[model samples]
Target: MIKGIYETHIQVSNLEDAIQFYTQVLGLTIGQLDEARRIAFLYMPGGNKTSMLGLWEQTHDLQTRHFAFHCDKDFILHGATEFLQQNNRHPYNFLNDRSSQPMVFCWMPALAIYFDDPDGNQLEFLALLGGESRADLGVLSYADWLRHTTTA
Candidate 1:
């Protein structure tokens, strides 16, 4: 049976720059590198071998991709948002709205903040809210989500 996502690959124009982004900015650990083949492997935080991200240098134009890292704590997500902002990086919503705040996904009861890498790959930090499943409350803006969660 399938357990969970193990790894994913994406194309990059440059390996060294991509390495810096994934490692320094996104906080992934360097796993392996093949300078000859222009391939780089990145591991998620906490040294989890199960999840990996592969960056392959390609000369051809590659389509941008979107991915998310699931987090379990609200503070971490919030802190990530702040960190990104402090670095002059902006965060956006699923709608591609750059509002500098986290969005509330009522369907998943999750709070998420979205941003993009240098290659324009959309990345997210998300956490489930309330610690339980609930009704689908639909997508909401950061302010609205805060109000709803507090008053619900």
Candidate 2:
């Protein structure tokens, strides 16, 4: 049985760029990097969390994927802004500079602002401290799987 998410893997175009982005911009600590520089691991010391990402040279482009982080809205928003300020790069849609109106999922309890890696893989900083009804959603309580659809 699954307990919790352990780590994640993502492919990047350049190893040094990825390392600089994750460590310098995002403030994630570099746990390890292989001798060949094709694989690297990152960690967020504040959250006791760890994730791995890998990149290798290829002739053709690779499929893009996203990574999301859950935290307080203000923390992630500020983090995104700080990242932009330090790296001298704007958000994919300028979320870091907009103080007038939120263009994305800010109104929702789960705040998700997306940016792209050097390879164009979508990445997100998500916040869940705002407003979601985590109250009375029904879920399966049985030990066994639902074998038949019961109308009654």
Candidate 3:
């Protein structure tokens, strides 16, 4: 039986750039690099050396992908946007309202912000929130989520 995701792979235009972005900016640790294969393996922070990500260089007809990183609530709420902006990454919510604010998926009750890598692959920072599922609410700003949580 499957327990959880241990690793995921994505195609990148440049392996070295992708490695730098994931390691220097996102703080992942390099697990291995295969120069002959143009692939690099990286370990997620605090993943207990289990979770991994693979980047494969593809020059022609490259297809981008999306993925999310688990993060702390405090970091997602108070620091994610600023940290991303400081690193020249533009954070946006699911609504695409042109704001760097995190949004809450009422169903999962999780807060998340989206950004793109150099190759236009969507990346997300997500933190699960503590509350009852509100599937009817869909996606909304963190402020709206807070308001509804208090009033309900």
- Which candidate's TM-score is highest? 3
* Per-residue C-alpha lDDT of model 3 across residues 28-122, encoded as one tens digit per residue: 99999999999999999975887999999999999999999989989999999999999889999898889888999999999999999999999
What is candidate 3's local distance difference test score?
Answer: 0.94
Model 1 weakest lDDT span, ten residues long: 128-137
Give one digit per residue, the lDDT tens place, for model 1 in 25-133. 8789989999999999999988758799999998788778878888866554458768887756787766676466677777777878788877777888888777344
Model 3: residues with Cα > 4 Å off, grouped in runs: none
- Relative to the unseen true structure, what is the C-alpha lDDT of residue 31 in candidate 3, on a scale of 0 to 100? 92
Residues 48-73, candidate 2: write the lDDT tens digits.
Answer: 66544445433367677877765565
TM-score of candidate 1 versus the correct structure, residues matched by position: 0.84
Indicate whether candidate 2 or candidate 3 has the larger lDDT. Answer: 3
TM for every model, in the order presented, reads 0.84, 0.64, 0.96
Give the Cα lDDT of each candidate.
0.79, 0.56, 0.94
Clashes in model 1: which pairs?
A: none
Which of the numbered candidates is closest to the native, going by highest lDDT?
A: 3
Q: What value of lDDT does candidate 2 attain over all alpha carbons?
A: 0.56
- Candidate 1 wrong stretches, greater than 4 Å: 131-136, 142-152
Q: What lDDT score goes with residue 104 in model 1? A: 76
Ranking by lDDT: 3, 1, 2
Model 2 alpha-carbon miss at residue 64, Å:
1.7
